[model samples]
Target: MNAPFGARGTALVLPQPYLLFLGDTTEPGFAKTAFGLRDWAGDKCVGEFALPGATVTTHLARMTPAQAYAEGARGLVIGVANPGGMIPPAWRKSLVEALEAGLDIVSGMHVRLGDIPELAEAAALLGRRLIDIRVPPAEIPVANGRKRSGKRLLTVGTDCALGKKYTALGLARAFRQRGVDADFRATGQTGIMIAGGGMPMDAVVSDFEAGAAELLSPDAAPDHWDVIEGQGSLMHPAFAAVSLGLLHGSQPDVFVVCHEPGRTEMLGTAGYKLTSVEEVVELTILLGRRTNKAIRCGGFSYNTSALGAEAAIALMARESDRLGLPVADPMRGGAAFDALVASCLA
Candidate 1:
């Protein structure tokens, strides 16, 4: 989830029913995170705990897994201060205490791969795997709306801060200009909207309005249509995989992925780095199809330079097309994106 945007604030009681705990309760972004909780839960959640300064012992003692879960914690999004945060001498005992309480644990960015074993015993006892949020950050609730009549949906992503949202918004603007009824819905933190800039939540307020419209009319232009802008592959969990799952549920008609040339070239093929463009692409398509999901075009997130963006988008298109799939046409922007969505419906 996003930290505070404009100003530094403490926790705000979120209206939403679900809660995701990031770092210690005192982190800079705690309040903003609480705001996200309220947004997602729609003002149903009691609120979240930041747990700063509170030792694992005191923290777990108060909440007690049984109490927390019984109070309606469907899932627990846990982010350690760090990997070592789990095994530290003081925390070890408290960790054990919380685990014994039987709370299902889901890991956020703070819980890396190497830290898996740190909580293994607790995880097994809890009867749930410590979900890897980094793979896609958050567990996207299946998109709940009228299914897209189309078949294609473009998905865009970049290594980290490569401007994925702007590219997605640009595509949305392109399609809207073409009269293709597009709404840029962001699926992750940047899109969840809290504060300053980057994927504003105001962008997706249309969903709320659409919900109101559906309740009122049941059938006007499906409220809004076109596009769903999303965050990049960093920050949260299984970014691509989770996004694809969301697409499956929403049934977007096309796909466009954003790629950064310099990053995609070097990191795209590497296995160890989540930055691998190729790995992300292959894994995304494979999992999407395997799960019977949607994701036709895998577009690239390019820099402002037309030449670089065009080249990367072209290469991705060629490679994806060679493999018989949809890829963004960097040079054609609006036409290419519109065509992909059109093709999905056809």
Candidate 2:
């Protein structure tokens, strides 16, 4: 169970094998949630359910609510984000249909799923749940900046939605594969859903953001490793607070800076250029030292998905040699990934 606020646990347990719902999303960027689920938690996804005119697809078999329900899907996760996180009127019928088909609705929208009259009423009538993942706990404590026990590795990024969550997940999995006890601590809606529990770091109050991070990774066994999911970039003008708070609160002994290879500028921010890997490392250590004096860089997790095989390998090698730190694209695990994993444990 996840303790989203501070120390207490969650009742946000959602049903498994989700049917991703992309409601008329035409643009690929708008369907990030759907794509994330497919990429990270593909096994838990039964199929996709999209409304009419949705060009964006997960490439999974398309299924309606009835077909998805029959295929054993228990939840219909709202997989597209509009400008305001508001549910359009056009999406209600599809949501209600899912409820009638016995699949609960899971959403990460700013607006509550249960607050929407049509979806709420349908769920109430069908005895199905309307899970809203973005809601913070009732009470959250202010950060005390107290350091906790055990080892923690947090993933920091150059910008949002690159590969922080992916790297954390991959690292945690690799750690466990080597018989090391590690857990992936999720911090966002997509990650929270995938991990089955997590602190909604962005949803937390500014004062309690650090406190929530503290509770999110409490004192564990000395050998245990909590691989915490990273949030926004420190250089990002809008969302640096959450990143700072998580850094100060988690008090990680090691941190990995995640970055995309081709991003010239920060995602969604035109004029602001993406911070260099070297600069990110320097700033992370400077700011992160406030909470954990022994804090150090683990390595780099590069999103080299867009690069060719040879180019990706070459880039990773060049960066690793220059920085004197292991650099690996976790998706292409090799000697580089092995070295990266070794640095984390070292």
Q: Which structure among the candidates has the greatest lDDT? A: 2
Q: After superposition, how far is residue 332 of candidate 1 from its true place, in Å?
A: 9.4
Q: What is the Å distance of residue 320 in model 1 from its true position?
A: 8.2
Angstrom error at residue 252, model 2: 0.7
* Per-candidate TM-score against the hidden true structure: 0.38, 0.89
Cα RMSD for predicted model 2: 2.8
Model 1: per-residue Cα lDDT over 1-346, one tens digit each: 2222223121111112233443343443333434333443333342343344733221222354456556765444443344343424444444444456544444334434236565676667555454433333112222355533432244546544455555555555555565665544444443333211222212223324223212211121543444455444421243444344343443443455556555423234434343555555665566445323555443444453445655655665665565454445433554445554444344
- Candidate models: Cα lDDT each: 0.42, 0.89
* Consecutive 10-residue window with the lowest summed lDDT within model 1: 8-17
| lDDT by residue (tens digit), candidate 2, 55-125 | 99999999999999999999899999999989999999989999999898888989998888888788888
Q: lDDT of model 2 at residue 116? A: 83
| Residue 207 CA displacement from its true place in model 2, Å | 0.6
